[model samples]
Target: MDALITEAKNGDKEAFVRLIRMNKQSLYKTAWIYLRDEQDIADALQNTILSCYENIQRLREPKYFKTWLMRILINECKDILRQKNHAAELDDFAEGVHCEELNLCEWKQLLLCLDKESRKIVELYYFDEFSVKEISALLEMNSNTVSTKLSRARAKLKKVIRR
Candidate 1:
């Protein structure tokens, strides 16, 4: 893995492709969980890959490639969300397709009730199927903090769902 990363950093396209191929699923899943929209997930994954390729030279530790990639992915997602929020002020709905249904409405309402960080914790832990440790590392947070966030998020979700 270290050799592959070194080759990738040295402008080996094949090595870079291999690295992306190996982590594609995880990357896509992470994006999906965060964005909650297929197009957003796709865009975020592409951005992350491009950023990784462009900035591979900045990676000092080869063993931390996964962590670094995840950080980039998370940052991309956050940027997207920020842009979406800004656009929402001028538009009715941020670019996502919506269907008419009571359940869907309820789900959207439930999601809307969550604070951003809590929503992120819930999405990463439950929707992405990430372990608490993984979530902590990916979010650059302590495991105990992740656990607390998850608990609070779940409790909030339950309250919203019950109402």
Candidate 2:
């Protein structure tokens, strides 16, 4: 695995493609949790993959490839959110029609009420199934900080959901 990342970092296109294939599901899931809309998820995933390919060499720790890739994906999602005014506007034609259901709409509204960092923590924890330790490493924060943020995020989420 490390060898593949090293090769990809060295500009091996095939190795990069293989690495993306291996991690695509996780990447998409992360995007999905962040964006909720299929089109937004697709756009965020594409941007992350492209950015990872372009910036792979900048990764200082090759052994931490998964976390590195995840951080890239999170940044890409944040970029998309900022670019689109933090409002994921999905077309009716999109396949993964999340907005069609009332339950998903309520969930999305609740998520949107969260500040970006809180939303990110919630997504990384609940959706991506990352541990607090893993999230701290990926986000370059202390584990205690991550735990505190998660608690605050859950409180905020609960407050929003109750409304």
Candidate 3:
């Protein structure tokens, strides 16, 4: 992989393509975490590939290629997420859905039963599918504490659903 990165940094197009192929699965999975639509995912992946190809020469550590690639992909995915949010807001406005007529989903109501902090934790863990370490780092909590909170949150949700 390091050799491939080296070749890519030297402007070898084939090596760049091979490197992108090697990280395709990881790139897709990371993009999926932030965007639901297939078009959005493809957009993010395409942008990531383009950005990596252009910047591969600037990467300082060949061994850290995957990490570098993932960081770029995450940034691209977040950009798409923000754009989607804005578009969806405009869409909802155009559709003229009344707030009063909107039904609260059981899942949303269940999440509301939790405290704000716990609600965020639950959303990051389940909805975003972030692992314990990822959530902990994002939330600045210890991994064990994140695990404990997730367990407690699950128990609370189950208890509520039983009613």
Instruction: Report the number of the highest-TM-score candidate.
Output: 2
Q: What are the per-residue Cα lDDT tens digits for candidate 2 across 1-163?
A: 9899999989899999999999887788777766777788888888888888888999888777888888888788878899878654321111242433445556666677667776767766765678898899877899999999899888887786567
Ranking by lDDT: 2, 1, 3
For candidate 2, which ten residues in a row score worst on lDDT?
88-97
Backbone clashes in model 2? 0
Q: lDDT per residue, candidate 1, 1-163, as tens digits?
A: 9999999999999999999999876787667656767788788998999999999999999988987898899899889989888421111122232445435445556766777666666656654566888778888889999999888878887786677
Instruction: Rank by TM-score, highest first.
Output: 2, 1, 3
Cand. 2 TM to true fold: 0.67
**Cα lDDT for residue 153, candidate 1:** 77
Give candidate 2's error at residue 24 in angstroms. 0.9
Which of the two, 2 or 3, has more lDDT? 2
> Backbone clashes in each candidate structure, one number apiece?
0, 0, 0
lDDT by residue (7-79, candidate 3, tens digit) is 9999999999998888776567556545656798899999999898888889998977876777788778768
Q: Which pairs, if any, clash in model 2?
A: none
